[model samples]
Every structure is written in C-alpha cells, then in structure tokens.
Target: MSKKILVWFRNDLRLHDNEMLVEAIAKSDEILPVYCFDPRQFELTNYHSIKTGAKRAQFLVESVAALRQSLQSYGGDILILNGKPEELLPALVSEHEIAEVYHHREVASEETAISTQIEDLLWKQKVNLKHFIGHTLYNKEDLPFPIKDIPDVFTQFKKKTERDAIVKPCFLTPDAISFVTVQDWGILPELSELVVNEDIEGLSQDSEFKGGEEEALNHLHDFLHTGEGMALANASLKKNEIVSKLSPWLALGCLSPREVYWKMKEAEANYGLKPYFNQIVLGLLWRDYYRFMFKKYRNTFFKPEGFKQELALVPLADSELLHSWKTGNTGHLLVDAMMQELNATGYINTAARQLVATYLVYELKVNWVMGAAYFEEKLIDYCPASNWGNWATVAGVGNDQRLTSSFDFQKQLKIVDPKGAYAQAARA
Candidate 1:
C-alpha cells in the first residue's frame, strides 16, 4: 500500500518557500493538496458586516486559482472546496485512503478552533495531523525567549529579537509533486457567492492589487530595482509612491515574510541600496510581533473591553456614527477620503489606516472593534493579528498599549495628506 497524505492549504498559499507542502511531499508517496472556503468566513458578523467583503473575496478567488495553476505545473493539483475543513477532510481521508494530514498552524482563536476540530476528527481515524509554523519572519523556536516571556513593548521586542534571533531560509519549490488522482476537484467560488452585497461586478474592475505569488515576486523585484526602491535610500519621495503595495499578497500568504526579508537583504548587498530597506523590514517585524502577541494574549484583543481591566468602557453603538465612518461620510476630508479608498480598493496607506482608526475611536467614539471588523471584511491584506492588534493599540488596550494622548488628527492631516493630493485623488 502507498503512503498517502493530505496537505491542507490555509493562508500559506504559495508553492515557493512553503514548509508544510515540502514536508508532505517528502513524507508521502502520494499527496493531495486541499483548500477550504469555510462558510463561516462569509457569514455576517455581530458588528453587522460581511465576514468577507466582495473585494477580498475576489482577491482570494484569484489567489486560489493561481495556486491551482502552480500546482498543475508541478504535476499535482489542489483539491479546492467551499465548505468547512473539519467536515470535508475526514471524508477525503476515507475516500482517498489517506494516511496523515499536514498543515501550517494558526494563532487566531477561530482558526485554532478549526484546527483542533480537524485534529480530533483525524485522530478518530487513527491518522496523525502535523503542524508547521511558516507565517512569521522569525520562527517561534528561534525567538530569544518563549512566547510567554516576549516583551509586551514593541521596541523591546524589536531590539531583543533583531539582536538575538535569525530568520530561517525559505524552502525552495519542489522539483515535482506525485499527486494522487481524485474525482470532483472543486470549483472556485464566485465573488457573489462568498460576499453579502448583491452588487459586486462594478467594483471588480480595479487591478490595483491582483492576488498571487507571481504578482508578489514581480512587484518586489521591480520595486527593488526601479527608482522607487532606490530613492527612499538616496532621495526623498512622495508617500503614495514610496509604498510597495505588497501587503495584500503578504496578508494572504502568497508572499512569505521570510522570502521578503531574504530578498530585501540580497537587494541591499548586491545593489548597495541604502539602509532605507530596513524600514520595510521593520514593518515585517511589527507583523511578526502582532502574531506572537496573539499567541501570548489569547483572545484578549478581541474582547469588548480589551486586555486591560481599568481601561474598560462601554463602546458607542450608534448606527449612524458607525455608518458614517464606514461609508466615508464622516465629514472629515482626509479620513473620509481614506475610508473611500479602502472601500473601493481594499487598501489604503499605513498612515491612512492609523489616521482612520484613530478617527473612528476618538472623534466618532465608535467601538474600536467595529472599525477592526470592517477592516477584516475589506482589507485585501487583512491578517487577523495585524489588523486587530493595531486597532487595539490605537484604542489604548493592546499588548503594546500607548501611554500618550490621542493623535492630533488635524496635525497629522497636514503631514499624511500634504496639500490634499491623496484626499483629492480619493474623492476623484
């Protein structure tokens, strides 16, 4: 009998630098790759937003299609399905006579719950489930301290980790994958099927951030080689032009953080690019910090009050205010423009994100979670930890809680949207 195993695809969607996929290929004679479009992701949240908005849904659809294409090129195919993984995998195992399951472990509670459910179900069949950590820039084992002892402050974490830790080299894409043939390979879900809003066609035209590893690698290469990558190191550039627009790919695991880190270092060494690339690395560090914080804090950031007790207060539930903020009708020119861009493009600049989050929490007095929830629905790059963790920080209740006064939005307005160009473009 052949050793058959199932490689479960979650957020880590790419063929290159994928540890779980490589491991599965090495361990089994025949392997099946599976992706589940969990219905829960598309359902309405308590905050009254679709769990997955149309723009994000469309991106995901394209990403999965790209993954399937990559797999086919490697003499394998991904088993795409649009249901819960726990319910789908057992049947797959039984039908395929699979021997084991492999997947990258996740930190968020809902994802953890689903993994736990699948593990228990697989165990009932006397099959083993293997978990790998592939998402963070620094692996958990390589961290200077255990997750529990990681500093609650961002600066401390950054200093200690950079000094003491190292990133593991990314795994190369496999030479060939021997696939176990299966009937009924599933179809990718339509954007309308995955989102609540009936009108999705009009917004599907923006090519600003198409999904896939190909786009990700291409963007990184061009950005690092072109004037945009060098100017920040050598000359001053406008804010919008400075952004690489790689977050959406990073969020969906189409681009590995490790790959980004290595490629940036290579670009610096070979081209003598200025230390400005370190700023990009710093952003990746913040992303890793948030994920590790999620493992340590364990659902505190998602609480109605937050991780701190004394900071507790009743959140404002004004529908009109929340709607105003969500729909870009808040009357603040810069913030309204930012929200409008996010709604249309599934993205906005980092500074704009911070400004809008602060506006939602301080000026509108709406619940911070509501704003985070909306981001979760809309951001093409919405990683659970990064989105929620940043919001909690702005709201004064994150792992790295700020001790300063609320942002002077009007002061920031001049700095982030200087001369109103970003605002004007957004409105146009």
Candidate 2:
C-alpha cells in the first residue's frame, strides 16, 4: 500500500517555504492538506474580548480561501473543516489511513496544548505527529545558543545571533502536489458565516490588510520591486516613511520571515538600496527572539506580574482609565489618536503601537495585560509570542527588564505625527 500522509495546516498557511508541505509530498505517495476553523478560536476570552475579532476573522477567511485556490492550481486542495483539530484530525487519520501527520511547531501554551492532545491521540492509533520549526527566520537548532541560554536582552541576542548564526534558505514552493482524492473537501465559509459581521465603524475603514500568500507576495513585491519600499531606502527619509506593515500576513504564516530576508537581499543587489533594510531585518530578529523566549519561558509571559519579578507598577485591574484608553477618550491626543487608529483599522504603525502601549503602561498606569489582551482582540496581525511578549517587556517584567522599558511618547508623537495628520485621519 502507498504511504499516505495527512498534512495539518495551522498558522503556516502558505505553500511557499512551508516545511510540512514539502515533507509530506516527498515522503508520502498521497497527501491531504487540512485546515480546521476551530470554534474555540472565535469564542470569548476571560477578559470578555472576542478571542478572534471580526477583522481578523475576515482576514483568516480570505487567507484560507486563497490557499485552497492556490492548492487547486497545483493539482491539490486543502480540506476545509469547521471544528477543533483535536476532534477532527483523528477521524481523518483513520479514514484516510494516514501513517503520519506533519505540522509546524508552536510555542504558546494553548496552541501547544492542542498539539500535545493531537499527538497523544495519533500515537494511540499508531501514527506519529511530526513538528517542524518553520516559523522563525533562523531555525531553532541553528541559533548560537539553545532556547534556555539565549540572552535575556534583545541587543545581546541580536548581536550574538548575527555574529554566529545563519538563516537557512527557504523551502521552495512545490510545483505539484499528489493529493488523496476525497469525496468532499467541504465549503469555505464567508466572513459573516464564521463571525458576526458587525457594523464596526470604530475600526479603521481605510486600512487594507489583504490576506493569503498571493497578497503577501504582492505586498513584499511592492515594498521591494516597486517604489514604496525603495523610496524608504533613501538615506534621508524619516523613519515615519517606513511603515512595513507585513505583520498581519507574517502572523498568520502567509509569509515566511526567511523569504522576506532573502528578498530584501535580492532587492539590495538589484537596486543598491540603502540599508534601511536592516531595520526590517532587525524587526524579524525581534520576532524570532520573542518566539524563542516563549519557548524558553512559556506561560510566565502571560501572567500579570510576568515571570521575572513582581512588576506591580500599578494595580492590575480594569477601571475608568482603561475604558477611556480603549474608547480613545484618554484625553492624550497622541495616545487617543493612536488608539483610535488601532480600533478603526485593526493596525497601527510600529511607532503608534509603541506610543499607545507605553502610554497604557506608564502614563495611564493601567494594567498592561489588559492592554495586551485588547491588542490581541483587535490587531489583525496578532501573534501570541509577539503580542504578549511585547506587553511583558513594556510592563518591565520580561527577559529584557534590565534594559530601559518605556519610550518618550510625546517626543515620538511629534516625530511620527507632528502635524497631527494621522490623528485627524483617525478622528475623521
């Protein structure tokens, strides 16, 4: 009998640079790609925030649809299922006679929990669930230090890793996939079918975060091959012109960091663009550091006090202050405008995010976890490692607490939105 494999799609949604997809095709005579739209993801959190907000839900729907279309073009298709992976994968495994399952590894507690459950159940059926580390720019094993010994400070980690480590080339996109033909692959749901399509005029109507691999590649292409990214490469441009908001796609694994890195190098070689490219490269490194830190420290990043020390700068609770901050009535024009932008568009540039998040922690003296949770609910680009890790760092209890924690919001606001142009856009 031919060795059949079931490839489980988690966040690493795209075919390009997807390790599991490449592995499944190579090792198995027949392959089936499956993505589960878990109801748990759409449920509410303890903080009363929708676990996956509508904008994010919509983006996911579009991404999955695009993936299916991409797969079809390659003589394959992804099984679009609407249930928990733990409940659904076992049945698929047995029904399809799958010998093994492949998926990308995750670091966060809840995601890991599901992975563990699926592994245990698969083991009971005499099948193995294999994990590949494809999320980071540098593979986990390629880091200069092990997860436990990575530097507590970002600069230290970055310097050491830059000096010693190397980013492996991305896995090539498969030209064709040999698929196990199933009678039904199921229907992809519309955004409204997945989440309540709210009349959320509060979120940014102008923000365009298109989902899926094609759009992601388009964004990267425009950034490098076209003028938007190249214009920022000018040595004289202010940092404000460099709004590389690729996080939404990166967060969902629609685009791989290594792909971005190599492409930036390609752009440099072709255009001799200035090294503002390194700024974005450093951002990729930061994302890797957070994921590695999450793997090292785990749930401590989620706690109010954090794992380092009791960082009780203020009481961790919801109050009128938090309400004002959330509603964009905080009375600080810069902070209010940034918050308004985040609410309206499901995104804010890096400066805006730092200013507003820092304001919530130090200036308003509100609970940082609540602020992070709000970001989790609102950001279309929300990733567990980056979101909570950033919050803990800003709250001064993360791995780099020894480093300076807060930013000069006023100074930053004047630079990024000096004329209050973004503020006017948010308020208008």
Candidate 3:
C-alpha cells in the first residue's frame, strides 16, 4: 500500500521552491494536495461594509484555478474544498488513510487556530504532521536575532542582519509525481456563492496583471532579465516608480521571494549592479520582518496597541469618515486615488500604502485598526503581520522612529504624484 500524504495548500501556491510540496513528495508514495476556499473570507465586515470585495475575490478564484492547472501539469491534483479546513481535513484524512499532513506554517490568529486544531486531531489519528517555512526568504531559525527579541525599529533590525544574514538558496523541484489519483473533486464556488454584496464587479481596466504562478514567473523575467526590468528598477528606486509590480504576486504566494531574489540577483549580474539593490532588498526585508513580527507577537499585532501595551488611546474616527476614506471620497486626491486603486485592483504600492495609512490615523483621526482591516479584506498580499504592523507603525503605535504626523494631501499630490496622473486615472 502506498503511504498517502496530504499537502495542505495555503499561501505557498507555486511548485518551485515549495518546501512543503517537496517534502511531501519525498515522504509519501502518493501526494494529495488540497486547497480550501474558506467561506468566511467572502462575508461582509462591520467596518469595510464588504469583506472580500469583487476585485480581490475574482483574483483569488482566478489564482486558485491557475494553481489547479499547474498541479495537473505536474502529474498531481489540488482537491478543492469550499469549507473550513478544520471541518473538512479530518474527514479527507480518514477517507484517504493519510499517513501525514504537510503544510507551511502561518502566523495569524485564525490561521494558527485552524492549524493547531488540525495538528491536534492528526496527533490523535497517529498521522505525522510536518510544517516548513516556505513563505519568507529568512527562516525564523536562520535569523541572527531571536524572534522574541527582534528590534523595535526597522533601521536597527536591517543594520544587524544586512551583513550577517545569509538567505538560504532555493531548492529545485522534482520533475514529476509518479502517480496521479484524485478520488473526487468539485467546482470552485462563484463570486456570489460566498459574497453577500449583490453588485458583481470586474477588475477595473487599470489592473494589468493576472493571478497565477505563470504570470508571476513571466513578471520576474520582465522585471529582471529584459530591458524594461532595469528601467523599472531604476525608476522605482529613484522615486518608487512602476518597479516589478510583483507585490500582489508575492502577497498571494504566486511567486516566492526566494524566486524573486534569485532572479533579481541574476539580473544585477547581467545588467551590472545598481544602488537600488538596497532599496529593493529593504522591501523584501519588510516582508520578512512582518513574518517575524507575526510569529513573535501572534494575535496581539492585530490590535491597536500591537506589541506595546499601555499606549495612550486617541479618539477614533467615526464610521462616517472611515466610509469617506474607503469610498475614495475623502477629497484628498492622492489619498483618494490610492484607495480607489486598492478598491479597483486589490493592491497599492508600498509608498502609497504608507502615505494613505498616515493620512487616515493622523489627519482624519480614524483608527488605524480599521484601515488595517480594510487592507486585510482587499489586499492580494495581505499577510496579517505585515499589514497590521506596517499600519500600526505608521499610526504612531508600532515600532516607529518617525514622530506621529500627517501628510499634506495637496503637497503629496504635487510631489509624489505630480501632474495628477494617478489621481486623474483613478477618478476616471
């Protein structure tokens, strides 16, 4: 009898450098990969009005569909389920006589809770559960500083690890799985199946990228190997230009950071090194830092006080102002444009995220937690730690060096987004 292994597919979507998939293939005679489209994700939120909005939901469905195709090409299959993993996984395990469950470790309240319950149940079944860290370039064990004692500020954290940190190289995937067997499968739920909002929406014409590992790899090549790659990097480094545009892919686990980092390094070798490596690497580091923060702080990072307790409370913005911000009717062109982009495409550049978050907390006097929740629902790369930590830091609540301040919308419009191109484009 072949030893059955269940690969619990979560954010780490791709086949390449997929630690969990690689390990599962090695350990099991037959591999069964499963992706659960948890229904709760599409429900409405109290603050944002809509939970998973149309654009993001559409992108997620598309990405999962792409993943299914990719797995089929490699002589395997992704069993699609449309319920909570805790409720679904045990039944599948018993039916398959699964020997093990292999999955990537996630660091969020809800995600961890599900993982914990699954782990406990598997233990009772005598099924071995293995978890690998495939999400970030720097593994938790590989970090120079203990996660518990990580620096409070980005500068200190970066300075200590910049020279000492060694990013583990990527591992090549096996050519193919020996056997392909799926007992039963079902269709993915439509947008209306999970979402309550009656309005059906498509990606706004501005969205240039699609969800999938294929598009992600193509983007890496375009960003790193091609002529446009160097240009985008150059422009983005100088002023946060249309560089790479890989955040959504990176966020969705369509592309691994290791894959991107390797490609970027190779591009540097081919095109000659530039000063922007530091800036680009810093963004990658931000991703790593958030993961670390999440593991260390757990659900506390989701709250207003974050890691620090005893912080003074400020009056939060009422629902009226938050609605204005979410609807892109705040009258601040740059802020409005950024929110509109997020609403239409499920993404915003790092620069835009920082500026808009600052505006919400300091200028509008809105709670940063609300902004974080809105991002959580809409963003393609909504890692809990990164999203909440970044917002809290910007809101003067998290590990921050800069004083609590607000950006002047008019000044930001003239400077960061001169000529009102972004504003005009989003408004249109």
Work out candidate 1's RMSD over C-alphas: 1.8
Candidate number that wins on TM-score, 2 or 3: 2
lDDT of 1: 0.86
lDDT (CA) per prediction: 0.86, 0.84, 0.76
Residues 240-305 of candidate 3: C-alpha lDDT, one tens digit per residue:
454557877787788888887887788677766455455567788888887887777677766777
- Give Cα distance to truth, residue 327, candidate 1, Å: 1.1
Write down the lDDT that model 3 would get.
0.76
Q: Candidate 2 lDDT, tens digit per residue, 116-167?
A: 9999999999999999988899988888898899888888999999999998
Rank list by lDDT: 1, 2, 3
Better of 2 and 3 by lDDT: 2
- Residue pairs with colliding backbones in model 3 are 236-241, 251-381
lDDT of candidate 1 over 1-428, digit per residue (tens): 99998999989889889999898889899999999999999898888687899889889988989999998888768898988899999999999999999999999999999999989999999999899999999999999999999999898999999999998899998998999998777888777778786378687565768888898889888888876886765667643447778889988899999999889898888766645567788889999999999999889989767777886575546489899999999998778888988988899878889899888888878888899999999998998999998888888787665533546667567768768887787666
Off by over 4 Å in 3: 46-48, 201-206, 232-239, 307-318, 401-415, 418-428
Best model per lDDT: 1
